[model samples]
Target: MATLTSVYADSTIVLGPLATEAQPEAYDLCEKHVNSFTAPRGWQIIRLATDFAPAPPSEDDLLALADAVREASRAPRPAPMPAEHRPRPGGVMPGPVTAPLPPPPEIAEGEVLRRGHLRVLKGDKE
Candidate 1:
């Protein structure tokens, strides 16, 4: 499966890798359609064939792996950070030191919504 994009102004058509995102001008085609595809007369078609097979690792890749392993093998990691330097998760986080005052001692049980001084209470009607 691949995406076919046409450039009318340049009279060109591109048959390439499937688009990551759909575009109004691009058409998604299956293998059969791609194989039997044709370009309009006087127009140019640029067909792109991509091989997805992974290539064998080269010497640079081996060297990079060796360097990483060497780094990993290096001795005792820097001594554990002192207790004071360690992050105290969820401890003493700075904010309004005083918590929002309790909801006015949970006034009346039927309270629905409260404004400054007025509270919309649930009506007794069902």
Candidate 2:
């Protein structure tokens, strides 16, 4: 079975024959279907064939793990913020800050047909 992983910064995807090894057959398949793959901008064939061992997670991963630990240790809910300290409208509490505006009224049947023709000409409608 084959699984496709993405090619970096490109629309084309790379196919993995198996999770273990990089398959050259996959690249050839993509080049055949994708039009953009020509001589110069030809698809990159990455062969994870050799003894190329993937690098371990870097310092960022370690830091993130530590941060997760610190967060989990703290109580789930923090002290309730005072009402005065909380965000509000006009720098103070008020009614609902925003309201939904009503939608435009339905157009007349004749207007709908005219608009449909215009949309068709503009390639805006299916």
Model 2 segments more than 4 A misplaced: 1-52, 77-126
Worst 10 residues of 1 by lDDT: 82-91
Could you tell me the TM-score of candidate 2? 0.24
Model 2 agreement with the true structure over 8-115: per-residue lDDT tens digits: 665445443435556543433332333233323545544333332334678997999999999988957788985543333224435553444333345554353233
Top lDDT hit: 1
Per residue, candidate 1 scores C-alpha lDDT tens digits across 53-85 of 234688998999999999899966888874433
Query: What residue pairs clash in candidate 1, if any at all?
Result: none
Task: Mark the 10 consecutive residues where model 2 has the least summed lDDT.
Answer: 113-122
Candidate 2 clashes: the total is: 0
Count of clashes, each model = 0, 0
Question: How big is the positional error of residue 113 in model 2, measured in Å on the Cα after superposition?
Answer: 77
- Tell me the lDDT of candidate 2: 0.46
